[model samples]
Target: MAPQLTSLYTTSFLIALFVTLLVAACLRAINILPGRTCHSAKAPRKAAPATRILIVLGSGGHTHEMFHLLRDLDTSRYTQRTYIVSGGDAFSAQRAVEFEQTLEDRASETRNKATTVRRRGTERPLCVGAEHFNIATIPRARKIHQSLLTTPFTSLVTLVSAFSPLFRSDRLHPNLPPTTPYEIAAQDLPDLIITNGPATGVIVVLAALIAKFFNLKGCSSRSKCRTIYVESFARVKTLSLSAKLLAGVVDRFLVQWEELEGEGGYVGGHAEYWGILV
Candidate 1:
């Protein structure tokens, strides 16, 4: 009886091994295995049609990282568009002109080397004015302070009135326009990628909501809509809790800080640790 039991166990082990080999062989035959996705596990897959990629970045090292990604994008599969909306020297009109020229030069070099011609350009995004304040201008600041001190309610009323047109919660509201940042960006874009800044993330979220509103599923207009958030812990750590919450809505989260690269703060579970861009 013992001999028979040992033989049975050996037979079961052999059968399981054969089944595993057979399943692996079948997967390899159909090119469903990881190594077979690309030819010989080393060669790259055939490039997909050009995708529309939007890089929404604040002006700083984060912006610099997006520029590097723009330069390296597989032109055969991606065309990059950039939107600048953050406040800094980089977001100023002068910097916008300089950055535009630099991006154009990079795009030209990329297009010359590949069959996929990239149609790239920059957009100066519209401001929501939610957090707009002018502290640098002393006269305006003094006036605002005087108003606040004299009549707090009046100041509050004035501020709300000033920003009334910018904030809309409902899609069907008559004041809200159907044309959103995503719709506007995706009009000529196949894929959209946004990086840095909570404001840019807001633009992407608005775009995705607009895409769903139009029912653009499965089409090119819907197919390439993707937002990649290039995150820096330095930046994330600096933001208020509400701003961090807002940043969580992006599609892909890529980290730049090497020491604190894993999922934390705003990124949560969907974060990818890319270490440093440079």
Candidate 2:
């Protein structure tokens, strides 16, 4: 009878602890998640001298669409670009390099065409160089034809690996202090994170959430790592799995179709439609 009572008490204590942890997680999520209304129009409280942007690229279609969405990206404003791709995804890495080359070429052409000496503050210089961008590879959350029963283990691995790129690594400049703008950007949290519906995208965003929840590197306090998720143009009626999962968490959830707007019953309200971006 004593043993039975001890078991019961132990079970009750575990249950109580579980409930406490669940409540704490919920409160933290609420505090960090973005609100329903879009705040992109508002000016930032304090702008950094150099801005860094992290872009997550997926395989095939997702990668194709992401570049299209960023076709008009102003390299001058986003001074540094970090491209994150899953391991063994050479195509995406190559694409990122090609994109940077294009930016560099465009900058060169603009400089050649300029007839007058540019005055200070009139226009920012183009951030076009190999020094301004980097490509990082992380393990895939799940491989093709992988068993679902073991997925949680692999996803956890992916989540843990995702945080490395989010934080500034000292390995970037091991021997010397960062002096240039590009070097400084490399050692700071990204100002923005952009992704489309990819398996790895969800994991990266979840990692960002965890960092913000703990205020890792002052992510939340500095208002850095703001995320934007764009739904695929093909999803006309319903949200994609990644879109649904991220609707409440990302700073902006944009759908190409009008039908998908207001679809997700998120605590932050509804998804937004800004026409077909891709």
What TM-scores do the predictions have? Answer: 0.44, 0.88
lDDT of 2 by residue, 130-152 (tens): 67888989999999999999999
Put down candidate 1 lDDT per residue, 164-206, tens digits, no spaces.
1112121223454446543233234335545554433444444
* Predicted model with the maximum TM-score: 2
Off by over 4 Å in 2: 1-22, 38-42, 45-47, 116-120, 169-173
Global Cα RMSD, each model: 17.4, 4.0
Model 2: which ten-residue window has the lowest total lDDT? 40-49
The deviation in Å at residue 83 for candidate 1 is 2.3
Backbone steric clashes in candidate 2, count: 0
